[model samples]
Target: MRLNIKSSILFALLVSASAINFSASVPDEGMFPLSELHKAGLKKAGLKISEKDIYNPGQIGLVDALVRVSGCSGSFVSPNGLIITNHHCAFSAVQLASSPLHNYLQNGFVANSYEQEIEARGLTIRITDSYEDVSKDILDAIAKTDDPIERIAIINKKKAQLVKEAESKDPSIKAEVSEMFIGKTYVLFKYKTIEDVRLVYIPRQDIGEFGGETDNWVWPRHTGDFSFLRAYVSPDGKPAKYSKDNVPYQPKKHLKVNPNGVEENDFVFILGYPGKTFRHRPAQYIEYQQKFLLPYTSELNDFQNQRMLEAGKNDKATELALATRIKRNANVMKNYRGKLKGLRNIDLIADKQKEDKALANFIQSNTALKAKYGTLMSDIDKHYQLVFTDAERELWFNNLYTGIRTYQIANLINKLKIETAKKGTLAQKNEYFNKNIALVKKELDAVYESYNVDADQKIAAHMFAQAYNLKDKNVIQTIANKNFKSADAAGSYIAQNIANSKLNTKEKLYNEVLNNAATLLAYDDEILKSQQQFAHEHAPFNQELTRREGVLNKLMGDYVAVKEIYQDKSFIPDANSTLRLTFGNIKGYSPADAVYMKPFTTVKGIIEKGNSGDIDFRYPQAIEQAWLDKNFGAYTLKGTNDVPVDMLYNMDTTGGNSGSPVMNAYGELIGVNFDRAYDATINDFAWNESYSRSIGVDIRYVLWIADKIDNAQFIIKEMGI
Candidate 1:
């Protein structure tokens, strides 16, 4: 057997991490040693962990309290079984569960009890208990099939067999035999999901998203970013739908809110589903970001923001509706700019490359194992090298322009007009067009607003002139012009035409053209109807993604096979969506020669950024004054409001991870991990732990938002001190 293929691979790597206490008694890193950490940290705190310390998180009782609200990790804080998570985590559900009169986000929502709690369709929470090491079985089954496609089929067949076996027994539990680190390993994780997870409490959008996109990533955070919800189970205690008879899901254990509050350097914890971070990326990627991507993106954001603001200043309603998209893109632009500058500093990335090469050499030492996964590691790097080049990112950005809301609307209007051609009735036509006329108006202005006509037309002309192979620019422009909202009529002109008898050919559209107020109305949004789900879902793109997965998986399996044979520590790819833990000390690094961000920030930093008029930097006046005047000695801000929060932790997380908890060994609420610094944007592909500080909006701020700020007593009480 190759050295890399040997079972000793994992043991050797642990030694390399210089992980404290190399004994078998300590739990493995994959599961995060939650129960062990609780036992160790709690006892040290003079707290005891008894059988009662055990938690039945949804259905996985074996998981300790630390898993609570982290990602399928939460304790039943209330006797009624309430779950707490970041407000953004609840956005999708809140969007789904909301109504015209009962918007969950605009005004904070609270369901008095379970029955009234809105069940947002398809939102699910699952707890896993049964995990079987099916690595050997799976690898053996797929060994002969070197072709990636065949290998995927073989692996899937094996996984299906395992799932079939599990279903025959429990029937209720969903059995998933999945690959970890790609096909290099397999784990059969059985989950008992609670489908009836309900919304219990959500803050008004003003508070939950207060400072909105401006305050999203940057900290010294006054953002009131928390929400509470619960899961309900049937009387029988198995997973069931919402019913009057069901009971509040009893969590493994609920966390103490620490209203007495967190102190600087106190052992604070955050347990929530953290999206993802790459702490093992190469330094070259970091350099590429600082040199190319950051400048391009920052320029792009500035250009877009200025154009949108200029076009929109004279038009308030036009700005109001489209500002949402502009604001979001600006946020990404800001995040990368900050992260790129922060990550480019030598301390985080220079040493990173040194470390990466060491891991590469470890693979080289084990000849037999190297033969299997050695190429896998190199190939994985190769894929990224090929796919993540500067040109590729530009290509990706160009693709995004196609999906812009303004662009989509232009196309939709033409489709609607074609649909109504032959149908004819004056009153019926008036009603139909009246419903959609606002869309046409918005579409017309939106296209013009998207870019200066000369610039827009020039880009259109340039794109058309320069391209070797091209699609319909004229069609796009045609849709942009006449079809988009009566070709520029004001609100009054539209109002008078609804009843006019002069036009009859397309009465439906004529009516809409006449009656549509310039502002958006209910029928204007497409998400209202879930049709064309296939085109919307983009079947072909998904098919390509699946094929790419096979390539990626084969790359994964080979690495594990070689690493195991070599008896080297197999570097597990950072969690794609499963659980993962990354640890680092609280420290600051040089942004350049003279610029050093002390590990934390003070309220003063907020004031500085505010006066600077950095559009991305937001500090509401009331909150800004409160922080400046308030006592924060107990909280350390080494720089002005730029303090490093607690160490970030969570299961796999990604784009949606904004405002997640960064828990510690204690499983208590600590800091909120908001955004990663930009220079390491590529870190999502790999972990370069040095540069990656899970940027957190301190818990002090969350409590501050609850108490001093919004002063929502209803919410503070629900935290259930």
Candidate 2:
């Protein structure tokens, strides 16, 4: 029988089957905030530490040691601020410090002394110092706004004012306001930004990125994907940029390394910032992502990867420069592929549809709810359909500007025109021009460093062809119709213009355009004209998209409010790049029939997988000899002669959780979380116990390599191993 709202509403709402179950019997899921851990069933899951041991604003604890390094997570392993994180997390910094003669990326780096540590340009580490609820403040400020846009503006103004006030209280503090629980909650986080980060140690590509793309998200992996960095501060022990006078930062608390690696079903928890998730989104959104967004993104990424590969061949400089870009593109491509497959396998759309139907039925059966939320689902669905109608064109337009250099140049030109129109003194105008010109030069230099004219031309041609072939008329089609006989003709014309344009050279740009902004503004440039026209035509669609998003945000917040009031179930806020704690056991599962994956992988697997000539499988001769000789030190697991490489757990995690410290029940560091299993990629939308698993590099393997291969005994001694 269909459930009647009047008779069964409370019972049905009390038990949220879709949410993470807090019972000990269920697989551990949910990225919970540190403040919520005390009430989040941690004790039932065998936590050995108190709530204050994980986080206490008044005192230093585990959260204090956890630092936001670059865009990933890392933890201080020593009081002097020796940080341990994933090698991929430090890839860009290593690349920046590397050159043809001193290739730190190909060969590993180890600092024997503090002075040997190299400066990592443009790298920073952030530590959260305090947090407070600001929900009441924001809600009270926006209580009178009936219009969604006005409400958003008021909320933004209040948040900005709060952050500014908080930051003004102390020079060392950087403040940000975070919206949580679908905007039902607001929290202001204050961070101490340490800007002088340095590279301490990193393994060679062979060990750090051993499996490469072949085993990126696969299980039973042997990748030793961990690196060490050190944070530095000014002589007065304050945040500052990199300098020789800086000293290593002394953190109040750092994690103790536990060489005794985890065994099966052992309690494990991770504390770090998870990037983002969309688990609370409606069924229509999921359908759009699965059917349209992922497919489109996957195709574009695949094309970019191919172009980058072709451009990198036989060119060492280009190869080195494009390595990070190639890796990023390939990672996203693989992720989208996995997400697409997982969505189909899990039938998330159908499940969401069922849930939506139940929600609709309940609302319809109640007089008050029927009046308030009767049209909510239909409204959202209609807006989503309208947005999807122009999805292809919007995708093409956005990506074309980012992918092509000419479009970027055109944007700069447009910006200069705007700035020129402003009333200012002659000196002020020149100063503005000079500043903007310098920025343009920097951007152009970066573009030319990795830019391949031929590859870009091919990409532009393909993009034009796709855009022109679409049923709807877009700016690309209009441009082609106005200027050329076909898409190929237009592409060739644009490519030639990019090749011959004076903007290609920085000196020309400065002398010709910077000093003569008015003349250039009046000059005829096909690309600039097309871009301006495109922006003009695209404004209406962009505005509509923004309006729909605002409406959705308000409706979703109201839905969350209703659910919280009516349901007795606990709800953890979705991830939004904030520090969170997720606990689970060291266990494994079968991804397919007759295929059971063990919880841990060992160095023996690495030996078996190694091939002498292959880049991904090859290892150093000394490392292979040490493995063959069975030189397993105290870092080896108990009752086993082999060293553990990587392990899998059921902890909930996402993108920014990479390099997060995986600790035992005692709050001791045991491993570093890096990637998720291929089948678990869909966890961002829906986490399934049967398939979801997070992969971490065992800390023992890291020490083993540091001792045997790198002979970095100093680091080991510093960590008290």
Candidate 3:
């Protein structure tokens, strides 16, 4: 049944199902519980998956792959620092370097020599290497303090000291050195970075991302989701900025793309940040997601897609802007649906219930565990209900964001200030202004149109009526058209209406802005002043949070120590956003016995989904022809034509893991993580151990696409295959 209504419907009656029993009608193969898979992952990560090993190699492998890839997460293939990351991670650089004459996204980019590569923007990656048992210091400090503010403060200061001490020893390491999972963990991670990065070679969109958006986040599908770029350093063998002289960063080990594809259950392993899985969430939270939130996100995404498609038809620029938003939202929607489906699986939920019962029984005798976490399930329920109550409000708030004009007043001031401060004469200033006039005009235009001067009055009316429990269509439509207006008339109308509104908040911030337009426009701006004020107020809050963040880290470690059970594959929440490692054999599963999945994908799948000329869809005749010519070697040939182009490996990972490299037990790159199973969103709160599939584009296909399809020899040479 499709849940195609307002989210309010959830308040009347919540759907009930075994948390694990819901399946996508995937035939139930003899399977382990969600808990066991996580346990398996922890063990592979080289941690004991128990309290005793919390300080050991806990999740180093997963952490290694979970790195902030500078611009994006990447895997360190060789000790020499040869890094492999996503093309999108490098997209900003491509954009910066691109021009009317050159479009990197369209034509792709390649650097035959190392010195020519661009250093991407503000990209940095970190990995956790150590953690201390600071539980005693934290408890003692908190025990001595009473006020929440002061207690939080003291905890933070000490944490700073600990991080400093930890990171000071290593020149290359960065320490977030702080807390996680509700203030109970601490960790220090190490990292290696290359300042001089070079673009080795990238194929045209037609070959690089063959299927593009159409094939995105899909399975049982063929899509060559791959790109190649190289890391470089200076002649001094030091990481250097882009210059005339630089060299490719030799890596620890780069995985040779095995054209001979993988078969079902062939040993495979993925080392990447498999974004969240709620394998641990209580039934109430999962149920809420399944019943309401998932549908809401999907509907909202659909609306966004509709708007983008409309924009795409006439305005290319508008289409581009909306395209990014829609693409992101669509992924979210896809995951929501996938998750909902997984959550609805009857067998999956049953398995979860059985495991939960077992866990409860195991903790029944542990007094401390019982006292501290026994109520966790109920707490989870409480939190879920609390969040649910505000579902509509959240939607309203999110929707309001569409009305905001970015730095509407402040952006103009900055530009004027820049023009005012230039060293040149008025003539020079005029020249600069001339050069920038179109951009400035474009900015203003964006604020005016995008802000929905009416603040979505039409959508607002529909929502408002629902909130007030009114059901009159005419009244809603009348209210919408009546409230909204063009930019010129909006200020006066809003100010007057806002002051009269019995409905608006007393703060009346928007009203104040509208009422005093003359003064705001005459001087710098009131909006700008407020922005500054907020920034100042936020500093102390930010510092305090950062400080207490450390204290919470140590405490969290202790918490995990108490919860870590070595018997099964289990996940621990990430702290300090550090890179983690998870290890598991490359294995395929029977979502049931009738359906067995292979661990790799083949080119044949791409042929099946081939499009004649979908702009976003790129399958070049050359690539297809290569396949028709029986171009694949034994390495490329998996036993089945249905080569698992994409494989869902069971590994615990989370958000900061885009483009993370997935390696095998032998430390070979098997795939690059693109996303997590939709059902895994709950993984942020708990590992839905059942839906713990880490989605990655197969390495073999990535190589195949580059070699046979794209016919780029430079990339192959640099990859050192």
Candidate 4:
């Protein structure tokens, strides 16, 4: 059994990141963790079932049906590990299995039998077994040191030890300790990881992504946005990697799909692993996002998207390979634009300022509070001031390392040289090479499989030009090793490096570069030499940022404590990729003075959009014909041939909530949550019921597509519909 070095490193880093955490929530603003569900007032808020039915400690319950499908949330809908999630969540797998001959991304996929299901490479699922609070242990360990860096080290070491102890009891478990609130609380979550996930059904792009970028975060959407998958385990009911001997995993519980979905004002809720939210941060943090982060990332993403488009022009294989990356970049670019708009539209910074001022006054009025929190706001402001000081320079170095493939490979080679030098004996060096050479080859193979040199060079040149525009000329001069009179000069230098470097092409990377790493390190290859220089210059700045984060963590924890006292309530912490419960009534909101968006969209909406001249709106002829023929079957809304396509609710959600099961009062699946309305994009900063509606494909629509259009009746029967 070989070690999975990549998985091990990722697990360690994630465990360490658990030290910093966020917010307090009112009932409506809360994505309440399962341990805190008792405070959510479920029955009082119209739950038809008991609380224990949703989460029963030491027993299987509705929460047992939930699973984390990669970054998104999903649920078991059948006794045999049949899982349902968003189409975009499974898009990469479909893209991987696709080709010009049988493009699954365009034509859709249906595995009529188990044998036909394609292996979903790099996609895995996790069922959370249990969680326990470990806040006291971590805080106590850190209390010995006031030095910020030392404190961070202590906390990380404590978390690692706890995870190791937990996993030692069971080899099948993957344990993680997540921060619930920065410097304040921590929880250890145990998950059963199944690596053999397969794609069972996925709709064509015309159906899954109808209206494409235009309707992505908009309301009254007609997109299906749903897909089906299956999870498999070893025959003896243990987690294992993909293999022929694996069988479908049988979960202790599964969700019951309700054909009769929700109506206006129906009670609804979601259970999912909602991603990060900054609702509790100080006003200065919001200022940082508004001023720099959002704009810079959005613009960079847009630039990359255009380069990809140009690279794939008239090349089918290139287009197929870049499909997923292009789609993901476009989605994020547009999402950030919306978030910027939403931040201004809601005046979020001004609102946060008002809250901060009120809290300040409250502290001044109480002698004890003043004593404890006198410098809290000031310290937080100071941290941001430091962040803003060198933000532009830091941004350049960060993106250079993260955004360039050649730079990454160069860094890895440099690392290998350092490690090899540490080995004092020939035998030890040989042992290292034997263990790692195969992994290096595997990584380089993947890089070449999707490599587009021309487009990437353009992107790299663009980034260099952008950095050269900074007001501080000395830093750029130091980095480039020369003074440039114009940004184009800087860009041209990097473009030349990328084009003429010895390791620019696959053959050169393997034979001249990877095979002779020591010679390249001792001598100077243009690309590797420049990358090493950048790494050397970046070391101090990165260290400073880490120290600042440690100090900020402690400051924010104090802020949380003081805010809790000021509000006189025990609040639900913000989401940090942990399982949580958020409930709200099915409703809609007005985005403008005269506009009132409806809560439900029907199949008629799909045809209306399809008739538009936009290619994104063009649907399959079969779908339009099915609508004209009134082929909605039993899935139609009562008293009409209309089938609800997508519905809106005000449930609090964020990025990782995609594919979370939307359940009715009785805890039966009613929909699959996918996106939030454009206005709700700002919810991550601050959420209010007025414009925080979430969108989901109604379950009736999911069933109708499987039964009437795709003819995947086996999925219908397996869901016990």
Best-matching candidate per TM-score: 4
Winning model by lDDT: 4
Candidate 1 residue-wise lDDT at 695: 50
Candidate order by TM-score, highest to lowest?
4, 2, 3, 1
List candidate 4 stretches off by more than 4 Å.
Answer: 1-27, 421-431, 446-450, 473-480, 516-524
Query: What is the C-alpha lDDT profile of model 2 across 1-721, one tens digit per residue?
Result: 0011121211011212342222223346688776556656777787898877887645667887889987899999998989999999999888878887888998989998999999876578998777776776787797777776677777889999999998898777898998876545677877899999999999998899998998888898999999999999999999999999999999878999998878999999999989988887778889988977889888987887788788878877767777877788788888888999999998999998987777777778878978987887777677778777877777877786667656676777777766765837666666666667667667666665556655666676677667656675334555645556676776676667667666555566667766654554555566667677777767876776666666776777766655543454556777888888898999999999999999999888887888545567887777788888998888787667889999999999999999999999999999999999999888889887889999999999999999999898888899987
**Stretches of candidate 2 exceeding 4 Å from the true structure:** 1-26, 421-428, 439-450, 473-485, 504-524, 564-567, 612-614
Predicted structure 1, TM vs. truth: 0.61
Q: What local lDDT does model 4 show for residue 532? A: 74
Give the alpha-carbon lDDT of every model.
Answer: 0.48, 0.79, 0.48, 0.82
Per-residue lDDT tens digits for candidate 1, residues 506-613, read 333344533432211223322212113323434454454456567777764454444443443334344444333333333444434676545555445556656766
Better of 1 and 4 by lDDT: 4
> Considering TM-score, which of the candidate structures 2 and 4 is the better prediction for this target?
4
Name the lDDT value of residue 224 in candidate 4: 94
Q: Tell me how far candidate 1 lies from the true structure as C-alpha RMSD in angstroms.
A: 10.7
